[model samples]
Target: MKPFHHLYGPVPSRRLGRSLGIDLVPHKICTYDCIYCQIGKTTQKTLVRKEYVPVMEVIEEVERFLKEETSSIDYFSLSGSGEPTLHSKIRSVIEGIKEITSIPIAVITNGSLLYLEEVRQDLLYADVVLPSLDAVSSDAFLKINRPDEGLSAERMVEGLVQFRKIYKGQIWLEILFCRGINDHQDELIRMKEAINRIKPDQIHINTVVRPPSERWAVPLSQKEIEKIKNIFGDKASIISEFDRPPFSLTEGNIKEEILKILRRRPLSLNDLSEGMGIPTEELERHIQPLILKGSIEVRSFGESVFYEVVKEIQISRP
Candidate 1:
């Protein structure tokens, strides 16, 4: 069976294995128009929180998925499309999931609203909160994230620090570095300072691997990534380029499975082939229908062609 509208995955995740992703906000509705954003630019860059999706609807889907499916879902990941915390009643969704199952909850956010006490309080029940911090300086923050006008790097860090103190779960702080932009010696030093304040349970370093919004958001070299690891010390780890195990597909529906995986983020044809263990020739049969049906679209990044679920009705292939 196809996944419910708001839910996707039980697809492979490097951080959370076989995660069932819940998309709260609409596509690209976020507080930051990050330069390196994989899903492209934020169409609605707002700090004003609202009920982007009905909390009860989200809860209903969660309940239904758990009751019907018997997939080995590792985490009930409350993340999809844009900012999840922006959903006004996200607390209810989190609490609702908790009421229904034993699966851990993860909220992947850009970490913009963590400065707000209400936001932090709402996320208190999560098993893990993966918040991102790509810049420490105002210039770098603006250049990299292009956050909502009032949202500054200092405020974001302050919120994260406060959350760390009160949060009872794991905080895997992610830092996305854009080469020559936020990966300089000075930037790393300032980043280390902010990281110390947050005191996250774990630190993750990530560079642009997938197709980013701007063509200029280049990937860093292995030597540079290793160097940053040294700078952040032991708690900091790089999100590996290597694929993780258990890309377990659903029982009988490959089409449903492909769309489910693509909805999370963009994946190259080879990425899909390698990760799903479907040969390129066989996978193309699946890909052809998805492309023809206007359910998914493709774009070229570096030397790879990446497929993503269509954001709008009109589809274009590159």
Candidate 2:
């Protein structure tokens, strides 16, 4: 299948196998200007939810992809650029996808907007909803998420609990933290109390593995993370690299796909490897020359390095 502009990454996911990412909102358009965000700062941080992308238009792209070619994708991920919930027509998109195929739908969100009944209702159709809760305290929330005026952390937590009570879906809550900020014993205990309210099926503990918008958003060590995992208990686990794609794309096409994706936005090595269905080792061989020739460059976002087009490459199809 040809690359769709709005559709990116049947990217390898650590938890959900190969995932086809559907970009509902434009780049960095989100509710939280999160300190640990891998993709960097938010350009529009708002509480307003609108039809960010035409829902029917994207459903058409999905139909084309599913009908034209076989995808090894385990799920269709409503995650790209920003929060999927902000797209007002996401419920329609989910419904439209259900009409086409039975593959499960997953949405990765910040959980900031989940407090709104409209937002929570819009996501009821999804099989999996992954939302993050980095801080439990108001002061910590402001320092971490940097949300808009009137957007309270307390309200967000209340919303999550309320949504959980009504919705019968998997809620895999993500907790992204940095050192000395929200990783202390007191902070961790408060987080546990807050998490109990949501009662997620799983607690995904992640850190700033990629370069973040804020340099101060440091990651906890593997040992430190594991120690905290014990405190958080059985449901808590670290999100790490899991399996490789079972298939591979033939030579020549891999580079084009990588270029096609990066032309839209920068991606980490793992993102490139997963999306292209190519091994990182082989991808590195092709990537090194592109970087050396000034076709692309590696940029660090936390500890993870991502590849983005150098902008002057004058991308004309060979």
Candidate 3:
């Protein structure tokens, strides 16, 4: 198979299982520069929606990958290093992919653009829309998300409420709590009120599990999150590790495959093991050499250790 610029992984996901990710926008162009973003700070933070990447090119890549790959994908996810809904022609991309395959479509977004009716309409065809709402109070929103000048916590909450009205697909609302930022009692009260109005099918509670852009952006403990989960009630649950059985991968070129996935986002050893279906011992053999040659480095976040590509190094494909 030739290299694909727009598509990556049938990577294991905690929520979406064997998701083949499709990148609609380039890296770091987003509406918010989140403190806890694992992908680093956003470079172009704006609310302007345009064709960031060629729509046809993305569709063609999805078609090609579907034709060549035999793995059973659970969802074709529109998510990558940046906010996907920022791409204006996302509707066309969704429509184009649907014409090619029966695999369900999922869009993982920040929910910042959902205030725009056109953006909601574009995502209407998706089987599941996973949108994040980290804070409901403007103070907490500003402190945590550092959104564009045009956006507000009020408007963002309203957007999710409106989207739930028109969108019949599943809405898995994710809320990532940052210690001392959005985890206050007042913020939680406001958040629960907003969640009540939005009425998502599932409320996924998350925290800073990866190395964040700001070192001060810390995670709440599991005990703290469990308490919040109880407040959110029956529909809410903690975002746990992917527990499904691993999928099979074609043997050989394990090193190249590891680099490809790590270039997108950092992954723990278990994440690599589950996603690639490669045993830990075999993967360690491939990973040690890459670390020795300075292609990737390990960073610990919370209790888990993650492997991320060293940005300055240019790793030639093996």
Candidate 4:
């Protein structure tokens, strides 16, 4: 077995179940340098979007994997490293994958670029768009998200509100609450107002769970998460931490393989590391090729960066 390269997990997700992620940007290249980010800081921050990786190569890898057997993947997610929308070729990539498979495609974004018509157009094809709105106030927004220049809380909100007018697919808006930061009564009220305007299909309330970039970042108690959820009504729910034991893999497949390990539930990086005894650095290297090819992606809950495969990429004989 070549080990599944260019893909990572059928990893468990808080929002999307059994998602396969597709990373289209370089590591940590995002518009925001969030304090609680799990993947660290934005080493290269910009609004520029271009083809960071070849779409054809990614499609080829996905083609090979789907040929073997259908795993438990539920989504072909556009996420990882930094922001997915920053990749200029995202539209082409999304369209290309759709030509091959009918798997529901999703894009996990920070909602920074939604103000741009181009950005909204690029995301229209996605079956679901999971965007983050951590704070409604600029002071708290800067304090928590640490976004790039010119990205204001008011401006970001406006973009989100506008995007909804045209987008027909599901919009699962996420709001990550950092204790003592954006998790106050006043802030939540403002967030509620914003949520009402956008009227997303789901309001995913999240907190810092893993090791965060800032030491002060803390996960909210179950009680606190519930309180916020109440404000949002039935569509709101606290994000549950997904945990699964890792599976042991053969030594030879350690480096090149991108195994979509069979699991009934979600798995974490610790599970994969401990279960396979693969060094963290080695595991990253194995997944790097996939990320570069736009076949895999990375996401963080706090300090932990989890990998998933992109399900949208499928190959067919002409």
Candidate 5:
């Protein structure tokens, strides 16, 4: 298997099956330099969406991996080192993948630019969309998300609400709460109202699980998480990270291929594209067979999407 630094995982996900990740943007090129970001602060923060990396390059990588005949992947996710939507070619990448495979396409994002019609249009082809809303109040939003100047809580929520109206695919809204930050009663109540307006298929309530940039960012206990889940009502659940069975990559030993890449660190689609030198369209082709055999899964961390090994079929080590 050709290794790339950009894409990581086919790691074990609590949500989607062993998933194949695609990173469309470069490192930390996001609109928000969130306080609790796992990848650290954004070095270049902007709302501009452009072709940071060649779209055809991403497509080729996907196809190559798919042709490798690996198994044990589920979703073909668009994510990575930075905000995916920031890449102007996002829509084309999605379209290219759709041409290559029938497996569900997922996009994990921060939802900052959903207010833009073009941004919403770019997301139209995805099977699932996961976005984050960390705070309801502007003060808390600035402190928690540390959004770019002029981005506000109301605007972000409005964007999500509008996306909810037109999007036909499954919407999973992620809420990452920081202890003593956005977890207060008033914030939770306000968040509940916003969620109602968006009406997503699932409400994924989470806290800091990985090493974060800010020391103040901490994971909520299961008990505390459950409490927050209760506030969101039945549509919500606390994300669990635990042991699962090995996912089977029936073709070309996909689990082995994905694991070889993930052994270094958690990676994104952009990571894979750059690392593998395979076009994104080709990458999608490589991932489709694996998804059918159930080797990978997809999960959410705020707006980020990650791939994990499925727990059923056992995969041999590469």
Candidate 6:
């Protein structure tokens, strides 16, 4: 299979299964520079919405991949290195892909722009919309998310609430906790109140399980997160590791395939093994040479070690 410009991964997702990621915007162009972001710090933080990537090009690539590959992807995920809603023609891209395949579409967003009618409308066709609400108070929101100017915590909550009223699809609201930042008692109470108003179909509680952009961003213990999950009520659950059985790594060169997936996000040895359907011992053989050549580097977050491609290295076809 040839390299695709706007498409990536049928990578294992903790939430969406084997998700084929569609990048609508460029890397790090996001509204919030969240401290716990696994993909690193946001480079171009903005509220402005426009066609950052060509809509037709993205659609064409999806069509090409569908024709060339026979991987059983669970969802066509509108997520990548940056916030997807920033792409003005994302609705067009979603509609175009739906026309070609029966696969469900999922939109993973920050929910910052959901206050706008257009943004909410753009995501209506998606099978599931996973939007995050880490904090309900302005101070906590600012500290945790570090959003662009003019965006407030109240507006963010309101957007989710408004979207719940209109969207018939599933709304899985994710709340990522960073130790003391948004996990305080006051913030938890306010977040619970906001969740009541938003009425999301599911509430996924997450801690910083991956390496964060800020070193100070720390994760809560499993026990602590479970307590918060109880507080959020019956609908809430912790976002755990992807536990599904591995899929066969059909077609692509193993070395090139590893780089392709790692370029989008850091994955542990087990994550790569599960996503690639290869054994850890065999993967280490391919990984060691890359590490020696400085093509990829290892990072530890909590107890898990992850591999990420060095940003400066260009990914040329093998």
For each of the candidates, give the backbone clash count: 0, 5, 0, 11, 57, 0
Better of 2 and 5 by TM-score: 2
Candidate 5 lDDT over residue span 96-207, tens digit each: 8889988788998999889888999889889999999999898889988888886889999999999988999999988888788898889899999999999999988888
Instruction: Give me candidate 4's TM-score against the actual structure.
Output: 0.78
- Whole-model Cα lDDT per candidate? 0.84, 0.83, 0.90, 0.75, 0.75, 0.90
TM-score of candidate 1 on Cα atoms, chains taken together: 0.90
> What residue runs in model 4 are displaced by over 4 Å at the alpha carbon?
1-6, 241-318
Q: What's the CA error at residue 278 for candidate 6, in Å?
A: 1.4
Q: Write the per-residue lDDT of candidate 2 for residues 193-312, one digit (tens) a residue.
A: 999889999999988776678888899999999998898899999997746645656565666667767755677887777666767798998788788888788887656788887655
Question: Which pairs clash in model 1?
Answer: none
Q: Quote the positional error of residue 30 for candidate 5 in Å.
A: 1.0
lDDT of 1 at 118: 98
Error of 2 at 257 (Å): 1.9
> Local error of candidate 4 at 72, Å?
2.9
> For residue 130, what is the lDDT in candidate 3?
98
